[model samples]
Target: MLFDSGVRSGSDVAKAIALGATAVGIGRPYAHALAVGGTDGLVHYLRSVLAELDLLMAINGYPTIADIRRT
Candidate 1:
């Protein structure tokens, strides 16, 4: 799945992963965060996205990202 969730939220990341995105490219959010809050913001954003993905996986009963499937 092709995903573009820069201005969006972590939930979108989870959705994309569940939809079969092997890789998600974070565009605008990352660049803007880096320009404003520096490296810390970028780190925070990544962490949040990862947590969202994990939470979604758990909610869907997927043991791993590889197990996430489109229903």
Candidate 2:
């Protein structure tokens, strides 16, 4: 499991996995997103965060989450 203070970027997610995290759990940010933007904002926040993770993985030569491990 990977833990951070509510990962805010895709690269952050990637790094967490690279450091050896089988699962990523997000918190705080979701609540903040909701507080700032409501349910719709939370959805958008999650999508963007996930998108960032995908992009970071693709660029780093990791085609899948399982392929990510410490460099």
Candidate 1 lDDT trough over 10 residues, lowest sum: 1-10
Q: Write the per-residue lDDT of candidate 1 for residues 1-71, one digit (tens) a residue.
A: 57666525666766777777767788987887888888998888778877877787788788876666545
Off by over 4 Å in 2: none
lDDT of 2 by residue, 1-71 (tens): 65665567777777778878776667888888999999999999999999988888878788888788747
Alpha-carbon error at 28 in model 2, in Å? Answer: 2.0
Estimated TM-score for each candidate: 0.74, 0.81
lDDT of each: 0.74, 0.80
| Model 1 bad stretches (over 4 Å) | 5-7
